[model samples]
Target: MSRTPDNWLLKVTGLTKIYGEPNENTLALTGPQFGSNICPETESIVACADINFELYPGEVLGIVGESGSGKSTVVKMLYFDIEKTYGEALLKPYANAGVNTLDESNQKKRYIRNHLMGMVYQNPRDGLNFNFTSGGNIAEKLIMAGNYHVGGIRERASELLVKTEVPVLRMDDRPSNFSGGMQQRVQISKAIANNPPLLFLDEVTTGLDVSVQAKVLDLIRELQHELGIAMIVVSHDLSVIRMLTDRTMVMKNGRIVESGLTDQILQDPQHAYSQLLVSSLL
Candidate 1:
């Protein structure tokens, strides 16, 4: 059956990834063996499989799953950090009506991934360069993405800092000097610097306190409403998903077990895993 397009800005179908099998023969000679059985030379494990989802413009799609359920892997594939083993990940451009499909062979896909998509990692430290000033870190992405003119770049970066609620006075300070919450705001500013059409937020508030998490979540909602940016938020926190997302997908062992409107899924979850997740939240 043909799938119906639901105002989708991004669509993923049957996505899968398997690692550590390509150089099995070479590894067999030098790699440590587990007893006489030789460890069977099995692949590491499938990080994700049969992953399918749709993200619409201005919609926050929450991907909630336990650790190792491939939530991060899905984000990596979307960001082109890793290649998918099978199936298609079609990113429909905001300006174009046609889908821009990606696979292992396309260099153009990488360019699009880097420019059109933005990612906020779980750890703010991973996303922001501690050595550089907060403004420099935010301006760096814009520069790399081809927004090279000094005047505009500086102005936009300063504006982004304001938008993300980071004080303009601290823009010259290194990320290491900022509080955790402030550093996270800097990271958010960096992610949104280019006004990307789609953004992947991988547990962006995991390490923050409740108040800070609330503030960050509110900022995300405000940005989404203002910019109409499509977002895929990978978070295990059910409350985060419920509060910020319009729709949600519940995953387990690299597969989606339940998906629907956020309220419906939370209020009347069908899958056992979904029920357990919801119960834990309550």
Candidate 2:
């Protein structure tokens, strides 16, 4: 995914994650590890291995595969939710002189997560502050991004809610009262609170009814177009990928099997797994 950088917001290469310790016979492992801390019964679980991709500003990249394909793991690593065992990712803005995010200080990583990146998990609970008011939820992010004025925060929060198609009057209510679709919208509103440069959506519409899923997906498309945010969307459903992504990557058993323009890959998948996925969709 790394060539010449022309307005690319992110460049990731060799991003990897393996649960548990390396196999006893493996020669080496990357990154820090306490070999003794691993559970004796656990063998290493390679969730995602050697993932490489890039995102141009405002482009939507989709990762699609059946469950346990390591698609979610890839996004989690980029979001810093899962520690990568090896590999480096570069966010162009912060990667001056080759600053690899996998090696960045925790403080800097936190700053990037709070200010430059936003995420919408399939479950609203993962992205939303369940206890906080809808408006307050967005304000939490704004506050972290260094916005201090209450009035400005409230205004922005309200704007985002309306933009995401949530009723402004419900801003004071907690997300616990919202329906599945409403909760996802509220989470979407909170994610874009700071107008972040990069956004991550992991199965954003996985469990919703068809109608509700369409609404959530539409809102995502609208937000991406309006905000011009580079985004990585991870979903097991190819339909979801087709609906929103510019480029798509197919994964299986912790590795990328195919990647290309969304339509091309969907219509003429090269990898055996990708072909099977497309056939199943039909």
- lDDT by residue (166-198, candidate 2, tens digit) is 999999999999999999999888888988989
Q: List the lowest-lDDT window of 10 residues for candidate 2.
A: 30-39
Task: Score candidate 2 by TM-score against the native.
Answer: 0.91
Error of 1 at 5 (Å): 2.6
lDDT of candidate 1 over 229-266, digit per residue (tens)? 88999999999999889899987766677899999999
TM-score, every prediction = 0.87, 0.91
- In order of listing, the candidates' clash counts read 0, 0
* Candidate 2 RMSD to the correct structure: 4.7
